[model samples]
Target: MTKLTLYNNLKTVRAQQKLSQSKLAEKVGVSRQTISNIETGEFVPTARLALLLCLALNKKFEELFYF
Candidate 1:
């Protein structure tokens, strides 16, 4: 069986937008550690949180995450 792994360009996108972890977290109602965890692939956000992040980052779902 083949497993799907999720990957993201969050760090790069976040850097390009000049948003700090704390700032983005504030916008998404999460913690800096949560953002860090997502960036490091240590956690997968809930679907609602993912959409919130997409809105906060001005990115589409595909732009934020992929398999």
Candidate 2:
């Protein structure tokens, strides 16, 4: 099985959008630590949450995470 790694372009995307972790968390309905964890590749988000993140970041899902 392919190990699922949490690969995130969150920091870059957030910077591009001029959004802080708190702001992004609020937009995505998650805690700031969740964004931190994702950005640090420490926590993999579920499909539902990934969709939420992609929407909040205004990015395609593939642009956010991949194998």
Best of the candidates, lDDT? 1
Error of 2 at 63 (Å): 1.0
Model 1 clash pairs are none
Shift of residue 8 alpha carbon in model 2, Å? 1.6
Report lDDT (Cα) of residue 18, candidate 1.
98
Q: Give per-residue CA lDDT, model 2, range 1-67, as digits (tens).
A: 8775557787898989999999999998999999899889888888999999898887999897877
lDDT of each: 0.94, 0.87
Mind giving the per-residue lDDT tens digits that candidate 1 earns over 35-64? Answer: 999999999899999999999999999999
lDDT of residue 1 for candidate 1 = 95
Question: 52 in model 1: Cα distance from truth in Å?
Answer: 0.4
lDDT minimum window of 10 residues, candidate 2: 1-10
